[model samples]
Target chain A: MKAATFLAALALGAVSLAAGAAVAADGPTLAAVKQRGHLMCGGDGTRPGISAPDAKGEWGGFDVDFCRVVAAAIFGDPTKVRFIALTTVQRFPSLQSGEIDVLSRSTTHNLTRDAALGFDFSPITMYAHTALMVHKDLGVKAGKELDGASVCVPPGTSIERNIADFWQQNNIKYKPVVIDNQKELNETYLAHRCDVIANFLPGLATIRAYQAAKPEDHVILPDVLLKEPLAITFRQGDAQWKDIVSWSVYATFEAEEKGLTSKNVDAALKSKDPEIQRLLGVTADLGEKLGLPKDFVYQIVKKVGNYEEIWEKNVGKDAPLKLDRGLNKLWRDGGVLYSPPFQ
Target chain B: MVEAEARRLVPRALSLDNETVRAVVLQVATAAAIVAALYLLGTNAAHNMARQGIVSGFGFLSQEAGYDVGESWIAHSARSTYARTLVVGLLNTLYVSAVAIVLATVLGVLVGIARVSPNWLLRKVSAGYVEIFRNTPLLLQIVFWYTVMRQLPPPRRALQPIEGVFLSNRGFTHPVPTWDPAHGWMLAAAAIGIGAAIAYRRAARRHHERTGRRWPVLWPTAALVVGLPALAWLAGGSPIGLDVPRMRAFNFQGGTTHSPELVALLIALVAYIGAFIGEIVRFGIQAVGSGQREAARALGLRDGHALRLVVLPQALRIIVPPLTSQYLNLVKDSSLAVWIGYPDFVSVTNTAINQTGQAVEGIFLMMLVYLSISLSISLFMNWYNRRIGYRR
Candidate 1:
């Protein structure tokens, strides 16, 4: 009787192990996300013009829109995205742990991150420059005037190196008050522990928006300090998923180049040009080849609109950010956002 | 022959030999199985991580950190290696922990004594402080302090209290000393004085032990410490000048200022940990039997002497062990400085991890640092406990 029971228990254990192995062998993250019915995208909750939640708790920004675009492409619904707010410190770990499918959290594409960290970056979404923001009453017009000054910057950011390099090249002496969070940096800057606040230009504009009642009190320096190419990041080793996200971003750029927007996508779908028809998913099996639905690009443009439309709605001249699309413009406009040929 | 046969028959009593050997075999097998399972899990992790093209090594430590820490104790630059950055982080951790320990101990001792006061109001207030701070989470307390500090008035409009001190949301600013190159000897003299004072303290203690007479150790030590440094200052003809923070149109210039985040974090850590230390102290005092205090009172000793000479010496035995743990906890809790943006060990390591993408290396360093701190505290406390324990 004991031998029979032992044999039965062993059989049951083998069955359970087989089941576990079967679950582990499930092929792709995209399919898993589709089955789960929500795209988990990591983003910043406080950065302006990037990803931040509104007072009503709705997530909206350039990064937020990109997450929505991915959701629209995958689930055919822009709202099928859950934004996981992460700090600069938490972003990569959260991505590696599969806590978020993509990290659209103002992550810079660098050699160390790409080669060492095992993150596959998408095409550059926004090219930004580091700038100094100071109180206008300081009479400091440029970075040079702020010699021997104290500056506040967030940690784990490239702003520190940029500021250091600038000081070294200019032979100026300055102190840095480094904090890990933007809120703390702003507080220190406003409190005057720092003579100037160093951050991305878009972030400076966001700070100015919150200080709009006293808009004249702050001035953003005209000097562009560091060039930061921000891109969306995904887990490495999944070439199919990487291509899907990368091309989804490229589709937005292609839509802008073709002047096809949420309003004009339907008309573009009926165009005679094969590339336009294929891009709109009215012709060709591009979506199927990319392991997405036939109308994936159509759904993305229709729901989230083109890259320019999304930027304009969230962070452009009409929005509270009032940012200019300088290098974010289409390739036809002599910008760097050049998408590959659809063929 | 009959006697031998009778002894053999006396007890074939449950020959336990086979059963004992079987149990030993079973236990060994179980242990081996557990170890094997763990090994398999580790090997599987290694295999999967390797398959993903991730490098499994600690060579990243020598690479450039390429990041800046906000409040490093050591000089750091982007050119600094990860090892140096970690050193800066460890120094900052030790710096904050040391300061917090000292502050907590002083505050705790006072409050603990106050908790047992004859005055109802004073006792109740101390008890209330203990209950409130000890019950609330440390993280929330840190956040509250940070918020309050941030809400202070701006720097340009700082509330000036004294001639050179400036107070604002930024931090407390005071006159900082700018030492001339000639004044370097004062620092050297002060270091020498400190060394001499240590030797003097040992001699005084030894003398007191040999002869049951106490020496005026305080005055001589103080003179050695202060007088030598003062003489150096005079001999150097005042080689140091005060650079008071001057409020300009925009911000304060010349003087040093700490960020409010650091001030808030420091304050929160001290206040929160101090309350727990206070409880340990009160219990230590109470643990001294009431009879001892009454007996001391019956003697010619004053109230202060009764408490100091009769009670405190005994009370320390009960208090020191728990007090040591509280100090250890304070050191560990200092990692919470990350919340308020005070760049401590964890914060700097987090930056290195993000910058380099070497999660294993970063996490290992973090674990090792925390473990070393914890072990050192435990070892020191254990030794102190043994020294003060009930020795015959």
Candidate 2:
């Protein structure tokens, strides 16, 4: 009887071990992040305002800041994040294969992506649109005059489809050159292999800033191809992790609306207002229900700053990109960047 | 006494010396294990995908691709289905493979012969060509070719070394024959002429075998093949016209053009695969014994005749097997055309995967297609090998 019982227990253990591995493979990314002690974020390390590495090999960009925000929320240390630079083609696959905890790449959130890719996207981080950039010598003002011209594009993006649709609808014929790497595409375009370069507006701005021989000689056509919402993506089936990320993004907006900045986070910790107190985790431990420390929002603001600060440092008028926060401003400021109540 | 000895012997099924039974058992065990492993992997992937909420099915193939391919041999649009896009990609892959294989074989044979040439300069140059190409990586060669091609002069100053042909950083443009209704009849005449020429050669061969008298049929066959098409075209008033390319505002217009991507991919595939094929050809020719050449020479065969009749016949027997593998490699390597936007099979599937978020299905389709192509190549080569091999 003892021997039979031992055999039964051993068989049961083996079965349970096999089942546990399968569940663990698709289970909570939160536990995996905690166990790994750092967040692995997928992003393009060359897009200046989005994600780029400094001379010291540390990444500091808007997308990189988002990764830091997630890191701060989980570990209370913004430095506990490792950014894995991925190309346009590699971002989704990297997320699906569980190579990264979150994809902070400037990827658009659309119906196809939301429904098809086994991933969930957080609220819109930025509103992006595709545009064409051509040499001043081309003597063309807009996309309409680019008939029979060659255009360079980065592969595995919506830009390729958008350009095709635009040209076809306008009854113009053009050739497309799909270079897999954005940097290489820019080089090829500058080499006159293509007549025009088509990419997202911010991407084109970054490329022009770094790669062009004379940045002023290039003209960004006033034609917009497609508007999309760029968001942080994580694998689906982990609703808890998705909610955590979503709320974390909301916290940034709520903080921005409350006139909170990284420097003022310490002072806000002592606020008397009930809403501000709950948001800073002073009056309520709301983060516990989301499997985080109650000071998650406080850590986020303290480390990565609010959305306004992030925008100013990375892509605002004073930055190298010098981009206006036209549509990315808070909802009250006549922009689309909005968040639900943190309570 | 014999009966008693037989009865004393162990039964074959129980005996270790039963080789047939043991072999069957081992093979069955291995096959079962392989099947079980495959089943487990498939089920695990399905379960994990389901748990992750990833939709897994071929239904996405019918969805619109919504992307433009750089160059396609078939009719394609932004609204084309993924299945149609895959077909276009497959056709493009075939086109590159077919053209590259023919060009590579021709170049390889010349280089191989040059490598063995008695002239010192010819041999050294051939050796250098082989060493430089085969030693460099194919991807680097492709990128280098593309970069060099991209550095050509702009459209306004496109290099027109020859009249009616334009070369620029954009691409190569030259004259193409404008299609006419009469061209269809011309093609049909050419086909019929080829058929008649083949029949004449067979008849001549039979005549020679029967009467031991040589019939000079080469000129007549060539005349029949060339004359029939010319005659048909003339009868149809020579409607064909040359559509020469001309430089327009931003690009060339009205001519057949080879895109920079296609040119780069072709040059890289030919240069890289040609070198490996050259070595194979050289080894094959060298494998034939010197005695055969001596015997042919003693029989009053000239150098060219001896190589054609005595050496190559033997060399080809060794060359075809490895040559088939190289051809398949070229077909597979054409996928690297994606690096330069050539819209080959893997590239299109990648776009489809990205567009539909159907990575598993797209990958599965690619595997099936590639496997079918590889198997077809293998089967054809095996058939050819059996037909040409020395019959014992």
Candidate 3:
């Protein structure tokens, strides 16, 4: 009876071991990420404002800043990041493979991408509308006027679907000339393979820069075809990672809402307001709860600066991108950037 | 017999006592170690994947693929399931591989023959062709082609003026012939004609073997192949119409267009593989002893006939195996389509893997597809090699 009991106990132990392994396999990716030292971030290599390399080969852009912000929050060093430059096709795979902790590329937050592509998107950062750009001599005023026009667009982009949907819904007939790369899309558009080029508004600015030598030749259509809510993305099934990323973005917004720039963050830390105190790590344990140091938010604001500062230094009017704040400004300033209360 | 054996004490042959027992024990222990290692690896991988919250199963394949594919053979929309998308990708891979193989073979053989041509210009040209194409990296070549193709003028100012064909940076737009319902009968008739031709050839060969007189096999086969098709066309009222491409202000309408990405990938694969095939062909011809060709010439055989009957038959033995490897290489290189966004099997599967988070299943499917393609080519080549092999 003793031997039989021992054998039964061994079998039970083996079964429990197997069950324990299975449970461990389902551990949250957020915890795994923290255990691993640096955050792996993926971004585009071409888009000027979103993510592109500077002359010294360091990445600097609006999306690139967010990556740094996340790194700053987690590791207390903004440079604690390994940037993986990816093409449109490679972005999602790089994220899914756990090759990158987050994808801050100019990816749109859509239903299909969120659910089908197995990615969770943070709140939208930049909301821009897709538009067409044409040569000035063409006299094309609006997308609706170019009903029978042929448009050049990059393949595997939402622009293609949007163009197709627009045509189908309106019973309008137009031809879509799809190319794979930005350079090819630009070339084909320049060579008159199509009447107009379709791309995101920011990308259109890049194209215009190329065509600027002959500036008298081109004009952007005064039509907004589709609204694209670009957001940072990460692999799904990691609620903690999602919260960390979500709140990191929210921290920037909250900082902006409190009129706390990097210069004023030190003074703001001594404020009496409960919300300000909680945000600046003076009277709350938000950072501790997130497995971060008590002064994590302070480091982010001081070192990385607030959302507006990052934007102006990278993609805003002062930067090389020279893009307008547009819908990226604070909610009080008539933009969509609003943060939930820190409390 | 047993009594005799006992009386005659023969030395025990190769006793399985000490050393043999040790050998068996060693082999068993090694196998057990290997099995244990494999078990550990499997367990560890399972544990790691579970810890990462990744499911290890083939169940995700049936889920809806909400992403759109740029190119597909079948009618696939975003609503189609992942399985169907993979099928489309697989078909595209096969399509490119099959077309590339045929083109490469023809070009390679011609250039291979040209390399050994007696004429100085032809030989130099062929050599230069092989060297230029072979030296350049395939990815660079693909990118170059894409760039150059994109620089072509738009459809409105397409360089080619042919009525039904338009060439531009976008791609070659051409009229695809639409077959009416009556065209099915014509296709059936053509198949019958081919069957008849085969029957006639067999009959002709048998007649020649018996009577020592040759029948007009070539003429009859040609008539069956061409004349039957023509007759079918007449009977079906020639139910084929060109759907000509029309130019609008922005793009072309009413015609089939091959995207620049596909064209670039196809060209790069063919160009790169064609060079290797050319070398294979050149070597195969050279492997046939020069003495054989000289002997044929001495026997009053012309250069063409000497090559066709004497050199080629011998050279084929050396040519086929490596040529099969070239075909396999072309199929594998089609994966580079991902770089240019051509949506081949690897590209689509990569996307599916990303979408579903089923890396193991996706990678397994990819490996299996490529493996099957390689195995099929090898099997066919092996059979062909066996049939043509020199027998002692």
Candidate 4:
């Protein structure tokens, strides 16, 4: 079990055996997080919409807000979070070392990561595909036209293998110039070191919309090289902590499906619907099951808003990336998002 | 005499007062402490990794490396094994290190001689070069050179200073002789010519010793080398072709292209190391006393002959030992190529670690490879140092 801390307790006779036992009862990671009075969330800090700092140095994005939802549920304060900037190579190691309580980074939910890396991913947060972006002057409309092209890829990402597999299947030959950082890869692509760039579709769209010198001059090829279902990841252990994180995110979808916006949530406290009353914490204490307050869902929605609100504010039509809610809509709305009943 | 003998002895051989016994006991304790510390660290790491569910060992080397290598001499693809990727990465490291070593040595020797030159302009320029390159950080210089390379004209607007060589941001390309079976015989002739020249030089030295007559070696050696290859060309009917590069859709197609990453890495390494090596060479030349120069002058040797025959051989003895360290440093510093997207050993190993999540095994291999490379360089330089020492 928690041998490291248990040995230290035996050494110092520290904090009373009762307090140590109490910590073990709840789970090590959450108790430690609570003792620190904040949650440490880390992610790729260079991507604009997924998780990066804005012009005022404030962190705002889908991933950053998702981290806030967890924070708000636990501490009842959306501000109880510190964001640690991580590179793709640094993400898993940072999580393994306890540098971050949760990886709100937009990482793919793949089997190897789940099993081999010892990570438990939350519900699929966003669905995207690895796509290629090239300058319009290249006159290439499809990925098949990318034969003999030099492609710039961020090193150590799944995008590298995805593009390679794509090329192999199509019988096309291409050169890969793997830059370690995404920001530098964009520069190299612009410098014509590469004729095309392979990245996550949302990431490529963010680049084309914000980082590009001329947004319209570059076109993202319509090809799904690989399906990337991004999610919130945490260390694999502590079933209670997993339920807390997973259900906290599920609350967002659950609220959106129930027509419970943050603006309308308070008025819906009196609604006749039994599930809505249970979800809003007016009837049942679902939050208490995960060791939060009776109204943790209400706290999360009030402080950070629901899934639709977070998406629309971060990467939607009015946002810089202006991405559509393509596959992220609710299940009844012809998309894949659905939440289990609050009961 | 009794007191001196008593000082060395003890009441008991096993006691700490016995000098040799004390020394042995202290060394044993220190060695034991080191071994224990290392064992603890190893076990602790293993425990923590196991608890975290992270796997260990080098078994991942045989798995297919799904990523493509940037530049590799060996055959590498997404389908190749991770072990093969390592060789490709190592070859890339060795290629850059080898080229940088030779070029830095040449540049350094020239600059060192110029620093002490009789002319005012040459001395000042060399001094300025040493100061500028040595004072700044090598990493900054690499990035500066990369940015400079990126600013060059695109492939379509490449600057051609010669008929066949093209220069662009993509990289420099020059016309190379196309492959032919006849060229293989020419290469073989060149190899034989080199062997013949070495024998002729030794024979000429023997003749000089016997007759006190200087046999012309340079002209004869050059004639044999060139004459053999020319004869082979004539016998093979003189087939020749040039693979010239021209503009294509995305990049130059025919001739070999040196990517900007390689060019930038070379310039940065050569310039930075050349400055340090220049100081070593300068101190080495100065270490040869004025007495040696005078002795050669007493024999009526001219200035060039005096410097070559007397001073250089002595200076080389001093230069080789320190030059060995610089060579080792240049090889290790090439790992910085990872930042600029050059697929050196560290760069590719980093990707492997990321993909496999086997940080321990990947890092151990990296340390092993670099350590081996440094040791080989050290050994070769030590051998040269021994050879250049004064003979009985």
Candidate 5:
């Protein structure tokens, strides 16, 4: 018994020493990310046109491409990215604990997440807005008409909370059927369990396109209940890592503005124009300032194309969701998407 | 011989053979070891959480929930605090569990009796119910029932099988009486009637024991309870008014409506727990010997009276213990209501955790709530079991 207790004590002593080392060893996040070899990208795996797995277990979507762009900027290989599917509850905790290097999940960039949670958000990737999707036969055009309507909302989402807020503000009484799983919400909504399904527009559009028998049978209300600026998030203490991620998004937008695609990246690399040459890492030392490879923008363009390509490939006209590039278009294209000058 | 005698008389100065000392040392050492381990783990967690900048405290309970629940027995709004949300969720959990326990007990007793009935069909049906429900998982049953409920017609095309009632995907809506001040008097009359019946039952039992004669208390007790209440209600001008549900633009209004989620959860919980309860009841009833039944019959008592007086009284002793366990199980298992989105204690707390990012406090509160509920149920059932228990 004495020997057993001695051995247990020794083992516990070793465990505590290891735990202390783990807590004390705080290295730069960029260095750690590089050592990990692959960027750990967290996102929603169930959102169809945003980030979801296909039939062959391959994940593809808009946010998935953003992660690949980040990977390409760092390693010059888009495939060197690992996707960590996280729920709303698991997303922030996972990021805070360094389980994932970056969180590109369709999470809103808000004051609470910014100031309180110690997270630094990248530029807005998707300008999302929540709206109510109703059966076209209901003839409801706005939020005010849906008094006493049964609404199906997925739990643990901003959409559910927004529905509550909208109803309270409008003084409209409605029954909310909160399903924890989005898939089940779709099932319940398809079965007409609720009169309306309230969610973000892209999500509603995707669901209507895929889950509905007759896509035209549903109509999204004109009144958007909430504005959601979805962005990429990382732990706050690492400004260098934040700059890398933030500018990675900017490079994609800049590439699109410069009329560059994956096909023309090699051509642009040989260009004589000082601005294009500087962007492609030929004329100036821009990459050194961000602690990335000199040809990071070239790598991003070559591997994942630009913002326009990413959008069109995921949720634009060529995609199944067929969402319009309204506020997401470049500033030159009559929209709000504009990147800071690379200089 | 003298040295041996001194050693024995002196107890050998607290040697291993001293039972009290040995036990005390072993128990204290074990408790100290456990306390040390827990302390280590707790400190480690606190250190890690602090390093990660995750706030650790119970201060978030007073914050506004900024969310709404679908159904609530008490007044609740988005402006309500997180503590109030948890209370609402707890009340919802208790509401479903209490109703389920009563329904399951009644159904289980009846089915259990039917299981051993002379009629072959009834016996087979009862056995089938027990086997099917017991074999399937409770969560799957809950989900299946929810899906079935969702398949009902939409509210615009509600199925009105009877006047003053509607059934649809939205829920079941039926006429409910709008009680006025006169109803209070009627309730008082009913309470008085119940009191008088109880008094007469004791008197009748005493008279039967003293004179070896039966007193007809059943008819008189029934009349006093029902007739008095009806008379008082009429005397108070029959103020109870029916608020029939009327179909509006979207759904039914002006009546008591049971949401489809509630109906689905109730059906699933009752069916699942009723099977286990039925098995317990069958075992308890069977534990009562046939000789007891024959003894009552030999004493010239009818089958109903024999079962009621002799068989049930003995069977109850065996049933109450297991029945208490089943009751507690039912209460704990009601947390599965989250699967069908019933917003029970765990469900609301889960949302709170997700929103606030205070996983530790949310989970701790959930554990405490469930533990307290289980303890309360156990205490009440134990008290009841003791009341009906056999005395030596």
Candidate 6:
């Protein structure tokens, strides 16, 4: 009997070691984060209005707040997060390598990524579009007039491929000058090394607002090259972990729909509405199902405000980008965002 | 069987006791261990990539590479395959490196000669050039030149430094004689003329060897080369059409435009590598001793004649070896074009990697191309060095 037990134990141990080499779908990602006591968030270090580091290496932006939301939901402290700066090419690999728990780099949530790249995406964080901007003196009014023009482009992104597709579809020709550094790309475009610059709308806005010699000297064309829905990415196959991350993002959307501002969240906790009570963890065990404290949503909303506050603070009219929320607004407000019931 | 019996008498012939057998077995075992480790690591990577849903293979080479290369010598477009893009990138790399090598050699030789010249002002200036270029990082210099080039006036306000040539931030454009079939015939005539000129020089040398009579070789060679091309041009209707660049809405139309990126990368690479080549050349000329120059002067030769006749011939034997390294370095440095957005081999491969998410294959392909180019350069240089080297 003793010999049989030893042999069975040895076989089990060997099988477990072999299984550990592959990323397991049913593995405990949440437990690993909890044990580490901090969340590792991947971000684009160069995008100003999206997710960039300050002089002191403190990260702050719209996409970065989504990372804070996840951190707050798990540890009840928004500061329990470390940001790993990633380039456009490094973002997916960093997440796949388990070097980061979440990638909130304002990357486009597309079919290739969500279905094919072994990643699950949260609901759209911001509705952006790949766009083209030119020097005001170039007299380029639209994309159709871009023949034989030299364009400055950022390397290692979908925009590199998307811009090519757009030009081919229009049956026009343009020379591409691919610059990897964002600041350098903007400089090259501004110096007239290239006649035009193409990037995401928010990125173009940031460059025009901050990097240009004269803000009025450049104009962004009104052409939607591609509908870019930026979303937070997660390693796929861990359904339990995906649930926690997705709901953390939705909790902020739910808070916005309920008109729960950070200051009013404490006051709303005492409300008699059954749904509000359940959402605030006053009456239900919804948070436990996702393997969290019953008051995870409360922590998230109180620490990082609802979706509108984040957008306004980071890239809205009140911010340097001064972007208008068109398709990024709540579903009831004519936008595409909506959260399921808290129960 | 007799040899095997003799080996067996030397105690444990195949084991550690026998020196030759022990060394061979040790080497084989170590090689096997290294190869086995590499195999394990490769399979582990393949497994991890598969688990992450990354399809790993070179199958993407045949896929349509929907990208544009700014400057290419090859017939390439957005409709081309990834394989064609690699070819375009390789050709651009080869073209730029080849031009940079020739220019840098000329500039370096001049600098080296100036470094040891009789004039004090020339020596100091050449020394300063070497010091400044060699001390700073090449990346910084490339970026500096690019930035300075960007400050040139736009095409509308382009500088007309000379007739029919415009300099601008857009690019430098110059007038060219419009293409005609006559020009093609003229080129072929010039090539044949060159072959005749070389043969005439060899015959003249043989005449000198037999009768000590110096033939007028220069005039004859020049007539054969230049005169033949001129005759071909006249025979083919003497086409004189001029194609000039005119400022269009975005850029100049017609003529040839050298993009600012190409010009800046070439300038920085030549200037930087020229400094190192200058040092090598200075040492080479200095290695030809003053005694040789004195001996030539003792025979009543002029200063220029003595230095050229006595010093350079010997100096060349020393210069050829180190010169090979500078040539190789220039080829490798051309890859830095990616930093300034000049679509060299590594730059386009980076785009391919991004679009396909095939970093491993892309990096491997880049290494293979650079290795091939470097080895070819080494082979040619070695042959040239052997030809110049001394023999008993």
Chain A TM-score of each model, in the order shown?
0.90, 0.93, 0.86, 0.91, 0.93, 0.91
Q: Of the candidates shown, which would achieve the greatest TM-score relative to the real structure?
A: 2
Candidate 1 deviation (Cα RMSD): 5.5
TM-score of each: 0.86, 0.93, 0.81, 0.92, 0.91, 0.90
**lDDT of candidate 2 at residue A63, scale 0 to 100:** 90
| lDDT tens readout by residue for model 1, B319-338 | 99889889889999999888
Write down the RMSD of all candidates, one decimal each: 5.5, 4.2, 6.7, 4.9, 3.6, 5.9
Query: Which stretch of 10 consecutive residues in model 3 chain A shows the poorest summed lDDT?
Result: A1-10
lDDT of 5 at B131: 99
Tell me how far the alpha carbon of residue A15 in candidate 4 is from the true structure, in angstroms, after superposition.
Answer: 23
Residue-by-residue lDDT tens digits, candidate 5, B229-324: 999989989775899998887888888889888899999989988998899889888999999999999999999889988999888888888888
- Which residue segments of model 3 deviate by more than 4 Å? A1-38, A74-76, A110-121, A128-168, A171-200, A203-227, A235-243, A266-278, A282-286, A320-326, B1-72, B161-163, B176-186, B203-220, B231-243, B295-304
lDDT, candidate 3, B184-264, per-residue tens = 777787899999999998998799799967677768898898888788788778766878888765567778988777888
Worst 10 residues of 4 chain A by lDDT: A14-23
Name the lDDT value of residue A166 in candidate 6.
90
Per-residue lDDT of B1-392 in model 2, one digit per residue for the tens? 99869755746674445655656655665565556555655677788778777888999788887887778887888889888988998998888988999999999998898888899999999999999999998999999999989889987898998998888887889998899877998999999999999999999889989997767787989888999999999998998698988888788888888888889999999999999899999999999999999999999878987997699989999999999999999988998887777878988888778877778788888899888988998999899988888999
lDDT of each: 0.81, 0.86, 0.78, 0.86, 0.85, 0.86
List runs of model 4 lying over 4 Å from the truth. Answer: A1-27, A269-272, B1-12, B199-231, B390-392
For candidate 5, give the docking quality class from DockQ. acceptable
What would the per-residue lDDT of candidate 3 be over residues A1-343, giving only the tens digit for each residue?
3433454565556556656665654666656667777788998767666677878988877889898988889888898888888866567657765678899977778876676556788888778878888877678777677776757766556676677666556666665555555665676677665678888887787667643456457777877778988889987777777888888888888888888898988888778888888887888888877777777778788878898998888777776557788999899999989998776
i-RMS for every candidate (Å) is: 5.9, 6.1, 9.3, 7.8, 3.2, 7.9
**Model 6 ranges off by over 4 Å:** A1-36, A96-98, B1-19, B197-227, B295-310
| Better structure of 2 and 4 per DockQ | 2
Candidate 3 or 1, higher TM-score: 1
lDDT of 6 at B257: 90
DockQ of each: 0.33, 0.42, 0.19, 0.32, 0.42, 0.34
TM-score of model 2's chain A: 0.93
Task: In candidate 3, list every pair of residues with a backbone clash.
Answer: A24-B51, A25-B50, A25-B51, A26-B50, A150-B250, A150-B251, A192-B154, A193-B154
In candidate 3 the C-alpha lDDT for residue B103 amounts to 88
